[model samples]
Target: MLLSRKAWEIDLREARKMRHSEVLGCCPHDCQDGCSWVAHVEDGKVTKVVGSKEHPFTRGVLCAKVNDYQTRTYAPDRLLHPLRRTGAKGSGEFERISWDKAIREIAFEFGNIINDWGSEALMPLHDMGSAGALQRRALMRLFHHIGASRLHGSLCGQSGNAVAAEGHPISFDPETLAESECILLWGANLLSTAHHHWHFCLEARKMRGAKIISIDPRRTRTAAKCDEHISIRPGTDAVLAAGMANVLVEEGLADFEYARSAADDLDACLEEIKAWTPDHVCEVTGVAPDDVVRIARIYGAARPGTLRVGIGPQQSRFGDVFVKSLSALAILSGHWRLPGGGLSIEGYPTFDNAAPECPELSPEGTRSLHRGQLGRILTSSDLDPPIKGLMIWGHNPLVNQIDAETVRQGLCRDDLFTVVIEQFMTDTARHADIVLPSTTQLEHFDVQGSWGHCYVGLNHPAIPPLGESKPHTEILRFLAKEMGLDEPALFADDETIARSCLPDGFDWATLNQQGWLFAPQPRRDPASMGGSLKMSMGLDGPEDLNVRDPIAIGKLRLLTVKPHYLLNSTFANMPRQAGQQGNPTLEMHPADAKSLGLQDGDRVLAQNGKGTLAAMLRVTDAVLTGTTVLEGKFWWTANEDGSPVSNRLANSNWTEGGQPTFNDIFVEVTATSGFADI
Candidate 1:
């Protein structure tokens, strides 16, 4: 037996297989591009993660935040086990605990809360931390089973979507951008937010002589590259879109034949636009009347003109109005008849799947709370049991939410018991009573739907759980069994869920090997539906165009934008990513800085009725005279010296569509310590 050469060769083959291997996965972060990636594992450790070269949409590209993902997974400060708070809340002091003990404690606390205050007292809050369908839905299945207060998502205004329904919302494939004649980046910071889409836009510009225009309050990175940038006033996007609609109709540039065939309310929309003349729009929007006419002509004359809507415009108090206005503009342009000639809102592809939320398990009339009002929900007397137990995952509200001070106060309550599932001790995690370690994308099984392009990705676990950490599904499974609950859905295997999410008859093993599959774009055009598009113009008269606020004298509209290197608070802690972002600075127009008697690099305080924030100033003309820009999703501890976070001054008020009005905030700035010594 010892001399058998065939036995030795068989053993060597097994060793070679184990030593080097590649696992397919999808990027879990909440980004427009749900990129497919390959994890190279050597000796049971992930050596590197690279974008899949075979993915048509990803094209072997990964954003700066995710290119070095192995570093993030193996970061020194990554949480490796369950822990219990050992000091005051928000102190970041915790002691390691056993997995069995951790599960038992959670079971006991959750049971106690339910018995004392009914299951509605328990609230589970989450955001798009991981866009993977399984990771997002696992905890929801547990919460629904327990009849906890449901979190009504606040990522966007559904009211705006409801208005979009009047006319079929057709999101043409971004790949078709190569065919577009005129591309209007309306409120879309594509170069910063969705860089993949910008590739196609650039191709159109260079290949077909396409005209690109950027319409925004600040001259964003995308705007800097565009042929023209229209610096419109904040909250006036609806006015500009309405003006363009008027010009399209008045100048006889509108596709009257297409409009009559595709839209049922064309006559009514005509009446609405009559009041939104170019001059009146200029008075309200601060855009030149001639520029409005010119842009309108460009869009109207092009056979395949298109518009791309962004999250920025819908964060205003009248977000629904903005969506409706933009929708009307596109409908009147009659661009949907051709490829790349319609409004493009990033959308997820549909799949044959089970209900991730398991709404069927929820009790009748279970209370639902909005995420925008988290502070109010926790502190309000109107809530009967008042959120006794809060479980958080997939979100860091303290850094991302509006009214930071109020959220802080709510988290600091002694009576409240909070459980946080995280990979790192984020600002919100530090305040939790129990911190459970969670696995990174490299250690999980997931499926992803792209909001940026038409592709679906598969993720296979590349390595075992690093320590006592587990995937969201495994964590929930352990807790579910510990609590003596027996829901079939709660115990479903991750691979099964992932496989069911794919199209029927798709080969799972083949998909795992290939990394991704092309999801064909659906036909959403009105002509295909055999019906006319019916939509409200969202404006009635001059009064509807007015967005001016009678604020305190020196107040300027504070515009908070997303950083290019960070997705919300996800990569804010990485040294390399943080270094790229540098210190957070408030950008003020030269005229505004001069009016306030301040210079660039000066330390200033922005205060409003809600709260105040401190930051260094950069005097630049990128912003308009009456506005200031601060781009970030920085952690609460971003400033090493312990200063307030950027969202402290944001208004918690909801938009007309029930979304956070982070862009509608108005604040006054004053020199705090004058120019920094450096």
Candidate 2:
């Protein structure tokens, strides 16, 4: 019963049968918007999937990447059965194996590793690939029982939340942004990433005539629609923020009384901003002094203006300072005190229900691995008991991690017994000793929520597990049985687990009946969190740690941004998404292209001390003269000779907040082929 790879639509018979019922579910991808969705199921097959129009924020619209999600579940290349590798690692060779045998092998290997090198050698790697409450966390429970090493870091690659939001990530009730007089979308491509929220921004203009400004180095689609687009230099977000504060205080637009109540050392903050003159800011941020002054005056004068922060700034050398500086402007102008004038850095941890209690089996001193530094962690020789069993679930490290070539090399090690739980045959899955098929979101039962929205979602099993794939809980249960352990917690079904994680006194039946559950939260004024405004940006010391005499270091700063079509390499395997997004090109300013004797469409090599990647050059003014842009996690697009794709350009050096400095890299560009007519 192999499905046609090219088939894009369900047959009439399947469709008619599925029309009888629609199951409620939610998209479990790594997006902040955990959009509630409806799966039209007929004859045990999902005919179609669509967003819930009833869901307030998603509003029935789905992103292009997820709109064709049914195709992904039924993709011809989907790993339908358990596979045991026969050829070399990363060779894409395997034979289908029975579930019992697969589980037995995994158990035996894991037990051997624990017996010989202690449980710490058995490393479990998991992340937000399947973000359902009972989906990804199922693996965590098992690892805790085994005492495997802990993975403590974020692949989101941003520490702005820690820097700006006073350690509590809050978005100012996105629904209230429409009342704002002005909106600043800093480093966020709202049109692409936060598409749904863009509608509210438009409404703000119609309702209140709010001025919308986009601050980015590139004139992104969102920037094009913005009333103003201010191009700032890469890694220089802090400078502009400081300069804005300077003008606000000097022009008497700032609310001194509000700052006095909310921020400690208010006078010290004001005195610091006085030195951040417009001319000094222009030199560091690459923005015209006039534009800087104009934006500051417009934003500072507006009451209850909203400030939206994105993950882009966290990729810089001083992302913490950059985000803190932006957050401070709200306090300086007393904008946080206004209804629509607060800041929304991120909306994670909005859900009040997360059960952190896990059975502690490992010793207290087990090593903790940073998820971003997988390459360096795997290749390191200083470990007490070297990582023998590497189990990757819900994350594609080969394509997404820093120094991916090194990750590839490390995965190929014969001594490492690797296991990957996945749906598609990803780059990381190809390197596994065993590939275990996992159920798609439509075929799983779980409770889900969103960081972007306040609605809770119910993911009913629209159909039975696809092919021989099992739901996450079932898989873990089978493994526990094979290992001869009968922990009642391990055998608990999805319903039981979901119920346990729900907020106290929450009724599952009622929540499902309503099709959504709204979080219990009263609207909070920003001034209520007095003295919690993160005043320190850590700017008293070295701000530009990456900057050195240009004579020795690479000149151009590198920024690998999220692709408009791909979601962290997940959709790269889809023809519709991957085909639409062709080869990865390095976009550079025309001035820099001319200086390097390069022309548009020329094959160029971008090299830094970390690694090098080759792509066709695009000479455009969309990028700053001293910086280059490359859309990332491009794994499906492969070169003839095996090489790293997107992560090749990024180094694993983290920021002050344990975030990957994906954008802090500096690269030297050279024309690999025919030169330009310089």
For candidate 2, write residues 289-400 as lDDT tens digits.
8988898898888877888878887676677777777767777877777667777765542343344225354457767877778888778899878889998988998887
The global C-alpha lDDT for each of the candidates, from Candidate 1 onward, is 0.81, 0.77
Q: How do the predictions measure up, each by TM-score? A: 0.93, 0.92
The alpha-carbon deviation from the true structure for residue 363 of candidate 2, after best TM-score superposition, in angstroms, is 5.8
lDDT of 1 at 387: 93
lDDT score for candidate 2 against the true structure: 0.77
**Candidate 2 weakest lDDT stretch, 10 residues:** 545-554
Instruction: Report the error of model 2 at residue 188, Å.
Output: 0.6
| Collision count of model 2 | 3
Against the correct fold, how does model 2 do in TM-score? 0.92
**lDDT of each residue in 514-607, candidate 1, tens digit only:** 8787775575765554446665566754343225431335578888887888877888899999899777789999978998899998888887
Best by TM-score: 1
